[model samples]
Target: MNKLRLRVQILFTILTNGYVYGFLKGKIYQGPLKYTCVPGLNCYSCPGAAFSCPIGALQALLNREGFHVPFAVLGFFFLFGSLLGRFVCGWLCPFGLVQDLLHKIPLFRKLKRLPLHHILKFGKYAVLFFLVFIGSVFLFGGFAKIPAFCKYLCPSGTLFGALPLLTANPLLRSQTGGLFGWKLGILVLILFLSIIVYRPFCQYLCPLGAIYGLFNRFSLLQIHWDEDLCTSCAACENACPLSLTVQEISRSPECIRCGKCVKACPVSCLHFTAKSNGYSTKHQTCVPPGTNTV
Candidate 1:
């Protein structure tokens, strides 16, 4: 599954970022297809990006002068969120692939738990609410729409958009200032942190991940836990990249559905399924660690 997911990630990344001409020439793809938003948090400002980012599109809609409902962008969120949840984060996001690859590097000791991990996880939600949702709507600079998250904080924009655009366009390069340096510093910090933390951005910063995560339990596709599997060993929880107790969470919001826990399960119980919460009991409760009561 890991290998298959890796292939899919690579293929999807290439498909979404297919415009080699744009990359070479440092121009955003202005084709008709660019209007379509992909499920992943890809930067549309990326010269090679063939599709718009969902987050970027959402911000654009909200950033407009009038406060009309962003039905189109909201529909995009609901459609994808209901269908796949944060599975897009695990298998589709270009930045996700970058972090996955970085975490695979053996240079540093990977740390899953931090002193304030539980508190830190809420950061993404704050980003979604404050920067993307609220900031985009109200914090405009004159008539221009300000995508607050992308313009200020998105590492994807800095890495895939601004960097390449500046590199190829001398005009853009000449206009670089302190804001560029700040964003570049953020990118560098995330890249460095990715070496030791698995998906630090998605876990704690990405507004898109926060939005998609809300649909995890409600999504059509989910990690199903078989209650009849006999022992509740907590092995799957140990294997979880996000340190979520897979057996108990019943499709945890933070779960990207990476299937690492499924692979590591001693009892072959957890698997991907479209069926909703098929466990015998209606109430999904956490079986204590080191217990076989489940």
Candidate 2:
């Protein structure tokens, strides 16, 4: 909801998917940048995408014949997670921007805490484990070379990849069948859910979020909590779309560092900290919940 964050999201989305020629021609870009992975979840199948999808790259590496290690993909995840954690999810992911905009539509009564929030938070991890890691490696081997997550569940691929490509390329449209319809249903369901629940896809399905969340505690960027300046007010919790308890927010892997809680802290007790700041955050100003802008 922050203007600066919104601007950054739009900027990154355009940078990652800036191929006008590819979009016009309805073809995937096969340039040198295609080999490099962007920090957030942009589908490599998108016509305008100039960068590789991180999840797609990981599947390509692991879906190899033997027990070859995906060192490059693993190292890429490590560097990204260690540096920024879910800041990428908060500020860069294209799909995240879609959900954010949908959440602001005011169509339905917004549910601050999504249904079964505590237990459903593990869904992303389950997807990362089963669909990505196991499904790619073992499930559809020999006969088919499909990346299970992208093929079956990635709404980003459906919304960005299938729609544009299918609309533009007749050859691609002729090939669509029950599988495409299934993916379309998934995309529609997720989009509908986003109207009521903020970031339902990020909360329940994105493997990338699961990976980055693991490093939230050890990432270079962090939200520091000042116990001394605390008034035990629950304003931060109420403001947080994910409903993270501010008392242990820094430790929660689910925290996207969206800064809503940071801005909602009435007493300036919560602020961003970098490792370069000697592990201590400054007493930055915070807007009260009533006065905070959307």
Candidate 3:
């Protein structure tokens, strides 16, 4: 399942960002498809992107006149989050795929875990609430011409958009300034960190992943665990790419629904199920981490 999903994600990445000729020719695809919003963080300014990023579009709407709500974008988020939660992050995000591949590079200095891994997972929520939402509504709404998160913090934009454009277009070189330097620095840091950590950006900074994580507890698609069939061997925990333990396998907000835990289950005890279908597993065994059993 992981292999098939990874292949699908790579295909989606290629399909969404397939204008290789545009990258070579130093031109952004300014077509009708640009009006559409992709759920993941592929930059709209990327020369090869077939659609606008939802966050970028949301920021644009927020920065515009009349204080109108973006119903389409909001609905898209609601629908996708309620259904798949961070499954999109696991199976569709181009940036997530990049980080996953980077972490696969054979290194003895493998950073399988980080200090304060549990706490750092909340950083994405702070980024979503403060930078993407409040900053967009207030700073961009009032004083700023550029979206704060995208202009400053988005490594995806710097890696996929700015760098490529700068490399492809010599004419655009004169426009580079201090902001470009800062973004480049951020991109470099994230790229380096991602080599050591599993999805450092996704776990600690992605606003889109944060938004989807909110729906993880109640999303229609979920990982269900049958405790009766379990030995606490901790294989699932070991297989998990993220910082999840065997206990949090069912509904951890940090879970990207990558199916690593399910694949690692020895007894076929973990499986995907609809949230509406209640399992017969004992309540004591089913509660998330820190509430009941460790």
Candidate 4:
């Protein structure tokens, strides 16, 4: 409801769904250089994508024969995850934006807050393990087959990435099998759940988001609070998409850098800050405060 929340949401909408605007006008930006990384999980197979998706690249590496762990891909993931954490999910991911919009439907019931929320958060790790470790390593005899993540589990790849590609390539569609059907089913189930719950992928799945969340507590970009200036109104906590209790610690791994808390703080008690080498430099607000201390 605050200016910061509005700005963050608007920025996210623009970045993720900008392709819709371009597509309507019959203009698509397709260049080889767009294959480069710009952070967040934008589907490379999306007809309008200018850059490659990190998860796609990772899966490709894992699926390649004699998989050696592509340093470039891993480096990109680490750089983006460490720098912004799940800020990407909150303000950049196209899929994340899709879930947010679906949650706006009036018929849906918001999830009951549960202890299982904390437990289910670990599901992404299991996905990463099964897809990356067991599926790629054990089943394929060391990544010699198709990307297990894309084939079996990745709803993003199934919905936004692969479906569009299959639609455009009839030859590709001819090759569809039980695996594709399985992934499609998973995608459909997740899509249905999105309308009923908020960010099912972000909360229960999405290994990339899970990885980035690990860095949210210590990322270069972070939310800062001064208890001295604090009012324990719990406004920030209520506003958080991840259901984080902001007063306790704004830097929790689950804290998506959405800036909702910053906007929700009536006294402006919450701020964005950059921390490095144990020194902190505060920025007045979260959405591009213009002071580049980092």
Candidate 5:
């Protein structure tokens, strides 16, 4: 397989099995642990999670019975987003990485590209609004709260997070009702669609990705383009899984910072840059150090 396929498979294996190292005799390893913010919408409830899930923490913050903003959690979210943009989604997220692998299946190909891409991209924001504003605010009635995103949507939480939790805890499973069934149905639908469509959850329903995407343009870590060297070859545009035009927005909200465009650019005109205090500088050469570029 090619490098992209290899990377996707390696990521999948790491996400699924690498966490095994942290578990011992059916319990989490108790050594001094450190947590970092992961970019996509994985759940903190997962037994293997090394870091807190921003969406889960966001809901908990909003659901706090009193007047308290979970500053630490929100701050971490912003800090991670500002530093990495959607790099987590591109390279780190288990779910996003899964979609990347699924989309590579040659049997299921996109019928058309670009025509409806812009319109469909709005769904993720809608999900964010509904969960944060309508569900969290309008419907919050004391501790009797519903994690709207996870309850009604969020397949990642359902499949990777909740299902495992339920399987491991019989008490949690016995308490399940119609709502749980509905969410499970939603998860099943999403999983089925993922086999055919390219990351339907990330594209349409990931609130965390939507939030991080807002900072994509101004994020400290970003894609830099040299307009002088670009031929407008459309190769980058075609390579983008999110269907973004690199020229229009190299750091667009839809751009996951996946580096597909960077690799696809025939002239090697695109690269990553680190920005500080409104100034940008190249951080890494297009090619790895000591590697010869063709």
Candidate 6:
């Protein structure tokens, strides 16, 4: 499944940023496709980017002078989120691919889990509401729009957009200041931390992931856990990249639908459901960790 995911990631990365050769010539792709938003967080300013970021587009629309619903952006999320949910995060996001690769780097002392991890997971929601939504709307009454999270916190933007642009254009490098240093520091920290943590940004910072996560409960594609799996060894939970247990597997917002748990199941009872399918009740019953099923 991971290999399949890697392939998909590569394909999407290429498709979304297909103008790679242009970057070498110090030119960004300003084609008509730039108006369209990709479900993932690929930056619009990326020299090779063929699509705009949905989060960035939505925030920009929200920050406009006149009130107008961003139907295109909202509809894009609604369609994708309702169909696959954060599976987009698992399979499409270039930044997620970067983190996955970084985490694969062998480390003797890996930071598999951290203290207050569950609590900190809620930070993505805070970022969604506070930084992406409120900050964009409130911070700029005179300007066009302010992508607070992208400008301030998105390591993906720093790595893909800022660094590449600055490197390609020497003039921009000469104009660097304290803000550039701060963003560079953040990118370095995130890169360093990705070697140890699974996906620190997605779990704690990405507003787009948080929005997609809300749809996981009712997404058409879902992870089905068979109650007839026999032994409740908690193996699936251990295998889950996002740390979801079998009981929460059905409709977990945190689940990326990566199929790691499905692959890890000893009884071969876990599987993906194209539609909502009822599971066998006689084989077993497992409660999610840190919660009572009742």
Identify the candidate with maximal lDDT: 2
- Report the error of model 1 at residue 107, Å: 1.7
1-294 per-residue lDDT for model 1 (tens digits):
899899999999999999999888988889999778999989999999999998899888887778878898889889999999999999999999999999899987889855598899899999998888878887546645588898789999999999999999999999999999999999999998998988999999998899898898778887777777738788888888888875445367788888887788788777777754544232244455576553
RMSD per candidate (Å) reads 5.3, 5.9, 5.4, 5.3, 5.4, 5.6
lDDT of 3 by residue, 55-154 (tens): 8988888766657787878987999899888888988899999988888887647675578977887889888877877777676546654477897799
lDDT of 4 by residue, 81-103 (tens): 77877777777777776677777
In lDDT terms, how accurate is model 4?
0.70
- Point out where model 6 deviates above 4 Å: 140-145, 276-294
lDDT at residue 150 of model 3 (Cα atoms): 92
Misplaced by over 4 Å in model 3 are 140-142, 279-294
Using all chains and alpha carbons, the TM-scores for the candidates as numbered come to 0.91, 0.92, 0.89, 0.80, 0.80, 0.89
The TM-score of candidate 3 is: 0.89
Stretches of model 1 off by over 4 angstroms after superposition: 140-145, 248-250, 276-294
Instruction: Write down the TM-score for model 5.
Output: 0.80
Q: Residue 274 error for model 5, in Å?
A: 1.7
Task: Give me the overall lDDT of model 2.
Answer: 0.87
Best by TM-score: 2
> TM-score of predicted model 1?
0.91
Better candidate by TM-score, 2 or 3: 2
Please say which candidate is ahead in TM-score: 3 or 4: 3
Instruction: Rank the candidate models, highest lDDT first.
Output: 2, 1, 3, 6, 4, 5
Return the number of clashes found in candidate 4: 1
Q: Give the lDDT of residue 77 in candidate 2.
A: 92
Q: Give the TM-score of candidate 6.
A: 0.89
